[model samples]
Target: MPASPDRLPLALYRAAQVRALDARLIAAGTPGFELMQRAAQAAWRALRRRWPQAGELCVLAGRGNNAGDGYLIALLAQRAGWRVRVLAVGDPAQLVGDAARAHAEARAGRVRIEPWSECAPLSGVLVDALLGTGLSGPVREPFAQAIRLINASGLPVLAVDIPSGLCADSGRVLGEAVRAELTVTFVGLKLGLFSLDGPDRCGALRFADLQGAAPLPAGEPPAAWRLAGERLPTLAARPRNVHKGQLGHALVVGGDTGFGGAALLAAESALRGGAGLVSLATREEHVAAALARRPEVMARGVRSANQIQELAATADVLVLGPGCGQGAWARSLLGGLGALDKPQVWDADALNLLAAGALAAPRGRWLATPHPGEAARLLGCSTAEVQADRAAAALELARCLNAVVVLKGLGSLIASPDGTLHLCDHGHPAMAGAGLGDVLAGLLGALLAQGLEPEAAARLGVWLHARAGERLGGAGRGLAAADLIEDIRHLLEEHSPCLN
Candidate 1:
């Protein structure tokens, strides 16, 4: 919660995994009730630090262990002399196991407990303890109504473990979900918290290993990992006598007719991203503009696929798509690309063409970067289906296309051909603009051309692009696609410097 660099959790788990870890801890030594108490203490500490001046506390509680943690938090608050009240959404009398014990303890501590109602007055910080990760179906009546009320309460909210009604496995909003300003999770980080609707609902995530349950056992790999500076691939410093040829050449193919700027952006980004030599093969009308804007790029106007073949033959890597219209010319160019034996980064209309079955899937090394809509089309599903389970969609895409897939969105997911997944939690809202994906495609191509494997290039490129967007997005709205080029170069140098 407090942006302490060292405290961030790197590994992420599914709801079932976290639950298993909890059970393991309890079985080893710690009691379930004791764990619940520790969770409460952790949440209380975070709540105090976040809203220290606020003396009143209102907790919305349900009937699971999640509600048990809420009851314990209420007890702690009351003991600390803070005004505390617990509105029980689930029948308190029916509470069992650790939850019942916790409720008894809250009553013993003189914490006011009352049944929840639509008319219940909400004041001060609201604590959501209504549901936990076990939820798999759509939120039911009263709980749904309570979550809606919580959202409309205009009160700062602190969620226990996870926000109520949000799927811990997929981060999907099941009919509805509570939007918490801050959430305190225990044991391990949930996969859902960083993707889909998770990032939006879980405002600021705080992890506390109450039982020191991390450093999980061997052979139990996480569903995915959060991309951080330490985990990033290094582009180690180049030698003094290095030649341009050693760095590898990158060819950017696209920019059909009116969409030439997209190809130009990718070429320029590739050059800035450390590609040794960048070449642009676009429509004749756009070649002059590409050369004028970025004279360093070897811009060539190609009227037919045969002309592009000549350029492709000399290139080490190809960055395909980016404003490539799905017209006759675009089809002709894509058809010619199948014969080339080069690593390719396909994006934009290229992805659309692939989805429409107009272009054959590349047999050689390739990486596909697709937004939700493009991903939906590629998988023969709807955008909502792709969004509902982004990880699944990305992995499926990678397998189906036999290429690394970068599913670009709020929390972009990079899925390797072998099914390994990584997530980038960087970037900002201002980055939701045109041409950014083109920039990313170019950057990915540059990284690949520079000798990084497709998987590594995708992971590193996504991180660099997102990090640059975050830096520029601080200036508020209107972050153009080209604005990230310079910043990305700087970030790349800092993260994977050309000189030590």
Candidate 2:
């Protein structure tokens, strides 16, 4: 059986890396054609299981091995007494090597093959084999139109290998992409399948290693790691004698005006996320509400950035910019923290301040939680550019800022300055409401306060926060940011018990 999405491997490779591994497998005795045949068989099995009642199959065949896999599937469906047709998008005559052989075999099996056109009618389970990872630039001409047709068909589309036109390395849609109901990918799990546009395009992912799950060669490390069970980095279980003092303190700064809820949420999240002590330094107006909301937090009202000095002196880790507005007061608060080399989680308007050049970037140990918009500002590019290749944007941001970065969005990515990247594909769309980023920032700060390294904290914090959101977001929309705080606290305990 192919690996289900939830049961996928932790290691994530780029398209080039997976290809290299495929070559290695071929060099180690498995023929390329045999691998293609296995891919087809895996895809066929998954399709039958997913859509058992659907007896008809339409294969959109390209010119590469992806097409070879589709042709073989068509033959299998025909043999199984199901009506099957192959739409040769890339001319079958242009097929080479293994693909050519597969085409000939399909023809010998009496499978109907016809040239593709925009007018072609699509039905049943549409198999997308039009483009694969080899796609270099924007999809052009007939292929793009074919992808559009597949998307508009309202059919149960099953993409072989990957959804056509989705970049195998970046999850970026190249002009157009197939919206597959189920995608059967082979060999290694591509990083793109779990980042950016990948989750939306490749629905219900299934992985087939094709008996090539051998260890990768040296000097070809995975592009990133997927945050999941067993492999997810976590904090150690607390000792029986552990005390609040040993748990560490986290200070949250922000809540300019009319945004007091953001600061309170962060403070509350920090307390619930296992920080022994959490402080909130915000505008005087918000302090009364902050105290009323979270009595345990040491909420203080400060007029100037200098007032934060005493509070910063006590915090082991700081969460900067939850509801911080882009005003002079916000600037002063950020500037005031520059002298202290505290581990910090920078989010919201704090990121804006850094991007706008209102203040110098914070030095020392800091982690950035930037949604695509903030990331674009930091990169000096448009949000579309950042979304186009989130993995690249995350790495660049980490490298440029000299800090761990959590590029928040669909598939939240955590990237470290040393090129280490991890992705959490656990979030929900219902988490679209405000203050979620603030909660994430607070959770990250709590992890940091508790002594996890910046990268480790980022990976664990993102995973926990996303998982909590996923659990609570099952009821659909209207998931408040405060809703995740208690769930995250419970999950943190479940992940690392307070007394183990």
Candidate 3:
């Protein structure tokens, strides 16, 4: 969240592709060794800025250009009279091109380079330059041993480029990845760095445009663009003449007899997210408590389709299914609203009903907010399958359903029916609690009422929700659905929307 998503372009690159670009740069007049030196300087500068007083450098080196960067770092630290050691995991002589030159330079600078061992004392800041991004499959033998050692060392690590064992394309850890305190990536930003295991492995991220004056050839975007608060358009300040009706009425239809709390929360979130005249069409049972909780919301007790008709007809938006169970009553209620004309948000058991062929979305502009399990069921695939490539899965679902698909998970990818994909890279582990999806659905519904496009609403609302979760995630752990409403309002107000 520290870096705006817009700061990094939508383009992404694989390890081989970047490496090829590096070679092309060398071929295009920039000396390969000069690029290596520039990279080393960049890493060193970032390392110093991140940890100003940390004097020692424990550089983990492999036989590739990444290790070359580490070796050059060791040389710089050694020349600066700081304690520096190169824990070589592979044969340094096997290093070719600028990497070999770096190894020679490190040796020339009288820097200590020794064969790596698990027992090697890691006293200072660790530098992970071992596997790099070109690596795939399992981390074999020595490198694996080194990664295990680094993890056990519990040292604050500065990973060079992508983490040692992380895949730049998909972010699937290849066996294991270095847990870095700060990852300084170079040139083109790797899309995987912000998604999946990428987020967990990359602690504090910093990007450096190593290409300098040269620009590389463009390639197909990885899958989606990162969703940040900067991407949302500024909501004009409410007019002095603004009325509850003018802002757009959103009717929340859900909450069966037993699960009224879910419906209440959705209505509450809709109101908080700036929907004017938020109404709840729930069971007659929970009306009093919802009224007591937030009297601003019009709590309507509806038993049949006749009751929902007026609300649905008048409201600009409809948020369907929070605690709406897949029971006969829930189906009967939704079936009645099937022909109604309104921009809708379908979620939870409503998605389940869609999968079961019991419910059909009244098309125009709609959003479906589905967590992994719900998404799997909707796509007729296992959760693992949906997560393997979340970007692809989200895009497929959006295209098939002809609605904005918010496939929520670690990365929280949002895909539009027209093939635009955006990734919401915020949110914390604490958000894994129940009722969060319903909150997001309601938030998006409110955004729709506010007149943001369906895709923009999904992207902006999700980013705000995730930012709230992160802000509230303290060292104490665990978060409730209701815990985020205030933070959501604060973030929405402060989020300037348009990217600079």
Ranking by TM-score: 1, 2, 3
Give the worst 10-residue stretch by lDDT in candidate 2.
1-10
**What does the lDDT read for residue 151 in candidate 2?**
87
lDDT of each: 0.91, 0.89, 0.83
Could you give the candidate ranking by lDDT, starting with the highest?
1, 2, 3
| TM-scores for the candidates | 0.97, 0.96, 0.89
Candidate 1 wrongly placed segments (more than 4 Å): 1-6, 214-218
* Residue 193 C-alpha lDDT in model 2: 84
> In model 3, how large is the Cα lDDT of residue 111?
95
Candidate 3 stretches greater than 4 Å from native: 1-28, 211-223, 303-310, 336-341, 474-478, 495-500
Model 2 scores a C-alpha lDDT of 0.89
Worst 10 residues of 3 by lDDT: 1-10
- Residue pairs in collision within model 2: none
Report the Cα lDDT for residue 383, model 2: 96
Better of 1 and 3 by TM-score: 1
